[model samples]
Target: MDINRVSARNVHQAHYELIVIGSGFGSTFFLDEALKHITGRALVIEWGDYQPWAWQVEAQSNSPIAPESTYKNSGNKPWNTTIALGGGTNCWYAQTPRLHPNDFKTRALYGVGHDWPLGYDDLEPYYCRAEQIMSISGDPDIGKVLPRSQPYPQPPHKGTSVDALMKAAMPDHHFICPTARPRMATANRSACCANARCSQCPVNAKFTAENGFPSLFSHPKVDVCLKSEVRTLEYSGNQISGATIASEGGEYKVFGDVFVLGANAIQSPAILLRSDIDYGQTGRGLHEQVGANVEVFLEGLKSLDGSTITTGYNYYFADGDFRRNRASCLVSFENRWWPFGLRKERGRWDEMLSLSVVVEDLPNPDNRVTIDPQSGQAVVDYRGESSYAKAGIEHVFDNLDKLLAPLPVESINSRIWRPTESHVQGTLRMGIKDDGSVIDQNMLHHRMRNLVVVGTSSFPSCSPAAPSLTAAALSIRAAELLYS
Candidate 1:
């Protein structure tokens, strides 16, 4: 696709009811819900192309394609989210886990992050709605754990050699069972038709923002500007007027009645910083929970030699630290290394299935994100620890080490790596008061009335489980705030 740019004035002088920025999961879910209530002209601006890029194919060549059909991030250019259509849903692991109610009330019960503005009960309907949209599949009855939605769209895929081996080795530690239902990829249909390890869904099984959002573009009222980038927000008075856009064709401006920032956690904060919009705590005190993988290769146990490795036991998800429990340290006997070589590490097919490891990370403010003056990009620096994260780490490795203790692949090695945040939250956090947060409980920007933020960034503290399901759920609630 060719790049083009237009002025905000030319694009929206007539005024659009809403303009959604970034086409990731947050925008997709929210926009879909918004259309249900507010019927007006909408505009969606995306920087990346809607189609798959060269890098995605390149990455797949390196590994057995991820069965869950997740977006493969190749650190080639600026982070790519689907710009042409579906956003990152074009590729995202379909693992959907809800926030245990304990996680939402953490701040009130435990002194971790602030308690969520809304509780699990308030968001339950949205969770149900999101589940239907994503077509989730899982067994929610794991003893005391509450299942957020109904049974997944499909039964959990069969476990692989690693799954069987872990069960044989340890009956004590329990890993959280992942849902096998398809992630919502498109709106009309909710499930994907693909293999367990298939990362790219063949039948729109997984729902991505693109799947839901393109409908908005098709609406006579909504106009989607592809490859158009928002560089700044043009505000007048307390309300937002429009936005300034930059693209290959140059600079332009766009006008909208309301502005919605769904640019993911990192980019949203970065955009605010670049726009010279500071809510005082805008970029300060950012938190990205860091994680590390610990590998255990069983001695004399060549049981891991298999083509399709699926099914996992994710024990150690809950050590009962409610405040920090949102950041569950997961231990799974799945493929150890990401199919593709991480960083600069070179690998072959054999390297992809070499061993399996579990990861535990602490949510630290030190491991936060800040703007770099030199490069002017958001940079992450992770360095924080919690007793729960540390304990979770220890528990996972201990369990793994014990399981493989008597096997030929006996050596157990644990190394700490810099944290990678999945359930990224808290940049534009919710709080009881204005000074304490970027947005109020309603997800509306505290300072800006016409702006709302949706996604993990709104999370004050990430829970221990998968945030995608919850993120989808909350955004549905956010859409309700606008539509309902």
Candidate 2:
């Protein structure tokens, strides 16, 4: 079955059974799962064009942090994201960790944030399914920290010498970080070459939306339209009727029985605000991870060499009584040595090691995304109270020497890499109420019966782990509910 690629001008249908916006994990996962249960016509509207693997690798190699040319960053804080077909997965580091069970009930356990409408157990099976699709690799023992119904799809990637040394030095604190890089050549992706460049795997070794679900595009029931920027949703009496889209050629409307907003945490809320929805919670509860990186020079041990980007992590302090007052911190040992730029100066770039600490940020209603009534652009007024995050950072700094005591460290320097909004979350929070939340457990709008929103935007709170895996699981779960 060939995927019918149609231009926005060629969509002659009066209405589709389902219309999904965005081509990221949220949209792709939902569509992939829905296709298993339903056979009706589905239309996917993507704002960006299809980016081939080789083209993405070459483009990323030239500009590491370059923003997508088609996206506009009108907000006070720039959202570092790609607008291409696979979305951020095109440039993601591929770190895939499940949110701890405690993450779902933070408000009940730690008294910091709101509890999710659902819990970790409800999504564990879906997490396994998502991991299988992404060809995730990790130590099965990671389930000790976060419970899992099944082991990862692949064995853990071989760690670098630096990772082994770190584990030996801090045996009680170190563990392998779960990742979405294929360990062996699979049908859709190649085995990782240990290039330390997982962000843009030159050989298409990293799992992404495009590689994971090639059949989704070509399925007979699916129709994909590229470069169709969705502007606003049309609704009547609490039911979404259609969406107004703008393309290079002109503007038009596409009707659908069910509408899904998967344009990510920022753009999704922006679209809702533009539609003049009265839902007070549409653009509230915005937050993201607060992160810092420390550079350490090992006196004798060799670092870098040839290895995966991130192999080991320190999660001993990820959770505990510390959650009562401050956020938990997850430390990752980064194997990418090129970022240090020490090769030219010392010629001993292998001696440099970078440890990144990420502190989870609680939701703050004041820190949110709003549309500029005048400019008609999304404006994020993010003033995240960092007291909890700062406490977590200070704890990591205080215990840094003790954790790396076995290593002969020449010097240690730390810098706070301010939040880049790369992990944008919690804009369209889910809850049991309509007054304070925009979506429900099924990701359906509290008031709009036929509308569903997927992705991190519906997250009530963030966990120490990366949100992509959790987002994928949630999207799949939402699809199942909608299909039923």
Candidate 3:
């Protein structure tokens, strides 16, 4: 199969009903809904070539093109993403958890960051739709914390001994991790083997754009152009007129009645900035939780028996009165066994557990993405992580031992700081007005009515959870609200 296929056709360039800028969760999920109802032509512009799952596995990389070349930055913080046809879907671990209800109302409930213009209920139905499309495996009991409309398409994954202990102790807060990794073998993929190289799943068990939404791209109404990077958007009055695209052949334009920017937090805003369409805090409020890794050494207990890598979560620390003062945290119990996962002692080889403390940070307008004048690529100035998140990590490091007091006695290792969460967000923030936001609650550009900006770029808050599910849900809702 040709890995780098580009359709030379003008895309019927004269007119397209919709022109989407990325093939990530935001674009694909939106097309999933739009194709079902809208009868017009849709064009997807992907910056990277379509490398199949088999090719990706054989290559041992998501893309032949490196992610670093897509942007220019001098900051020490690493920006992680796959710049390919499926975007981050090719490399993400697929830990699909919906944001807690309070995550929508940070200002109202926790008296901190701005609340989301839309709430959990607004996206709840679309969340179910996205989860169904991805065949998400999750514990239904998680509905206790975040309300659900339907049962998960797949059953909950098995838990490790550590997960079992935590759940037995805190039934209300601890639950099987909601994931896009299949629990059982499905027609499209096999069950997860738990090797933990989830970035590039060796067994092809995780939900990727290749397996999960294959039909969405191939739909008769949709047309895709691979290795075409959109540099800027052109608009007049209050509508998006066209986009300047850089492709293998040369630079060109693609015209559409509606445009959706799904090129992630950094690139999306950079595209807008390059177009000279800066407004509504175009490249501001960039934020994401940079959390800590907590490795627990157990005495007699053994772990790593789960069906998936991450088995369960302790949400007790994820939300509480402490959120008012410190960032909220979602603690994930990693059910992974490896050479590094083992205890050094011969007798206690399996007596170890790994936990990831993911914290929620308030948006800092100072941390943002801008277009570098020299290269015209994304320049992410993102050093402004909140003290709220830092305090949240400290809280976990200080009290995790006590929280695990019910379990076997052992050493709780020092918290190791992470360089990046791999989730970039809030660059093109959404709000009720156009002054301090790019898009509205419905994902529509506040001033450019026909232009919709989807994905984490429109996120108002940086929740600790992975952004894929919420991104998918928002896209689906955007299509539904616009077309239906």
For TM-score, the strongest prediction is: 3
Could you give candidate 2's per-residue lDDT for residues 86-132 as a string of tens digits? 67777777899888888998888888888999999999999999998
lDDT (10s digit) by residue, model 3, range 1-484: 2222336246525578888898888887887787777668888888888888888888889998876777776577877777888888889998999999999998889799878899999989989989988899999999999999899999999998888888888889999999999998888889999888888899999999888876677777777888788998889999999988887667787788889889988888989899988887898988777777877888889877888889988788888778899988888888874324577798887788888889988888888888888878888787667888889888888888767866785887656888889888888888879448778888999888999888888988888898889999999999989986
TM-score of each: 0.76, 0.93, 0.96
lDDT of 1 at 438: 81
| Candidate 1 residue-wise lDDT, 396-456, digit = tens | 5556545444344534444554434344556777766665578877788877888988877
Question: lDDT of model 2 at residue 472?
Answer: 93
After TM-score superposition, the amount by which residue 98's alpha carbon in candidate 2 deviates from its true location, in angstroms, is 0.7
lDDT of each: 0.57, 0.80, 0.84
Q: Give the runs in model 2 whose Cα sits over 4 Å from its true position.
A: 1-3, 61-76, 165-172, 343-349, 416-421
Question: Among these predicted structures, which one has the highest lDDT?
Answer: 3
TM-score of 3: 0.96
lDDT of 3 at 418: 86
lDDT value for model 2: 0.80
**Clashes in each model (backbone N, CA, C under 3 Å)?**
58, 1, 0
